[model samples]
Target: RASLPSGFRHLPGHFDRPAQEALVAELRQVITEAPLFTPVMPRTGKPFSVRMSNCGPLGWVSDLRGYRYQPLHPVTGRPWPAMPAVLTALWTELAPDAPPPEACLINFYTGDARMGLHQDRDEDTFDAPVVSVSLGDSALFRIGGQKRNDPTLSVRLASGDVALLGGAARLAFHGIDRLYPGTSTLLRDGGRINLTLRRVTRAA
Candidate 1:
């Protein structure tokens, strides 16, 4: 595989179409159990364009109270659905040195929906890397350095592609600029789904 900057690993077409479909089907069940909820911006209360849910023990949420991880769904008040073994296995294969992930954030995106550049810093430990899998459609993913003004790299993350943020790149700023509709057949609808595996607690 070609090398990227330190701590940044991009594996194109990491999962085949069949695997993507299988994962999507599994996520369907997760959505049924946990359901998707709109995450709000802290203080502003502005809702994000994407709807999200989680698998594993802790889930990330944002509302008037603020952005934080909780044991239960903000609305349903139930624990998050267990993460599928496919995801857990992927994480173990990709980040063997890190502890098992406790959270798998699922993001559903549609046309015109985009995530602004931000750092994933809420987790307690930096020892573990974040493993993100892209399914359905394609997204223009942006990556910048730790500083806000640093140079950035734009990569098209298509269905089945995976990216890992570890080491110095773990705290790098990143986000999805936009989605290219009709780019992939993984999702019957012209939208995208992103699965991110994270370790919320400090490594023991």
Candidate 2:
């Protein structure tokens, strides 16, 4: 287990093969129901680099108008798939300081896909941490401070890896530089799937 700079926690290969396989199966079923789609950037209307969808009570959405959380899939107009129990358990274990995540954003990254540096600030609550699980191929995760241009650090996230960004680093600017193709033999073919759990709404 490697402790990331900027106080982020990197639990490498935390999930065993059985657990990873189970999570993948759950994700496949969720995708079959909800499907993955490219979200557009707010204002620009340009599609996001990474194809994404979600499960849980709410899902993250971005468009020409702006970014926000919605209860339904934009394409299907149906409620997003329910968050798998394994994910909920993992979140509880990894981020005990945070409340139960209200949204789980599943991002599908092909060999060429990449995410730009950005902070996750859509959630109303900042007291919780963000739990991210990586499956399939490896990816270069760039972690920086709260400021956009602060010095950053890079880490190779592999299958079954979990990264916890919480406490002071909860709002740190981070993104995926690029994915290392063909790293994991577990993926259906070859791709990276990242599940990020966050509390998008306040509990009433």
Candidate 3:
């Protein structure tokens, strides 16, 4: 946990082999209901390197219109599948004090795909923490301060590892630098899958 910064916690191997397998099975089902779609950047409409999908009441989406949360898939126009019980249980176990998450953004990275430094700020509020669980391969996860240019730290997140962004680090700048293609055997085809659970709307 050297230089991990405050409020940003990384729990490596938080899910064990069997739990990870179960979650992967559930993710396969989620993909069937809401197949992955390529997301584009705002205005420029530049396609992201990763394919994305979601579960829960709302799903995060990006395009020429920018990032936002909606109940349905941007392409299929069908409501996202309900948040699987396993994910909900994880959230409850890790952050019992916070309200339950309403959106689970599923990202699938292949080849040399990587995400740039960014903050998760589109949500209505940051009262609840952003919980991310890594599966399939490993990624070099970067984290910086509230400012975009703040000094950063890098950590290798393996499958079943859980990372948390909450409290002071709720809006911290973080992203995936790259993936170690064969680091883990969780996915049959080889790649990395990430499940990021968040509270999209403010609690009543």
Candidate 4:
């Protein structure tokens, strides 16, 4: 893999096949408790192609009003499922210096779904790195400098891969350009699941 921007770490095959499978099983249970729901653009009210859910103490949500992190599910009005131990363990291993993660946003992307390049600025603090785990189908992950128009580069992120955006790349613009379906059998059906762990608030 080519050199990525500073503070950007990509660990390909970070989780072995068995580990990925176990994580998938855990996520299935998470979905049962926190059903996936479609998020909409704040003003246009157009739904995002990817469906979303969350775990941990807080969840990231976007709707007609705007994007923000809250303690409960927008649709269920109940607190999100607790973050899986596997995920919290990963955070402890990878981001030991940062505060424990409080939000794990789960994004489910089907074929033809794509996310435009954007910055993750909803959090109140940028001190902790944004840790992401990729599963199932491979994706073309595009990343660039903090500015939206900065020269961008794309990388193929396969299942079990883990990416960390911190320091200089913490506020970088990034997104999934497209998916290479059938690349991995992690998911029964062909699709991709992205688990993004973020520290939503500043540590005391």
TM-score of every candidate relative to the true structure: 0.97, 0.95, 0.97, 0.98
Q: Residue-wise lDDT of candidate 2 within 15-124, one digit each (tens)?
A: 98899999999999999999998899987788987999999999998888898999999999999989999999999887776678999999999968999999999889
Candidate 3 local lDDT, residue 58? 94
RMSD of candidate 2 to the true fold?
2.1
Query: Please, what are the lDDT tens digits per residue for candidate 4 over residues 1-204?
Result: 255689999999999999999999999999999999999999999999999999999999999999999999999999999999999999999999999999999999999899989999999999999999999999999999988888888989999999999998999999999999999988998899999999999998
Which runs in model 2 stand beyond 4 Å of their true positions?
Answer: 1-7
- Backbone clash total for model 3 is 0
User: Residue 30 in model 2: shift from native, Å?
Assistant: 0.3
TM-score of 2: 0.95
lDDT of 4 at 48: 98
lDDT, candidate 4, residue 140? 98
- Top of the candidates by lDDT: 4
Ranking by lDDT: 4, 3, 1, 2
Off by over 4 Å in 3: none
lDDT string, candidate 1, 108-141, tens digits: 9999899999999888888899999999999999
The 0-to-1 C-alpha lDDT of every candidate, in the order given, reads: 0.91, 0.89, 0.92, 0.95
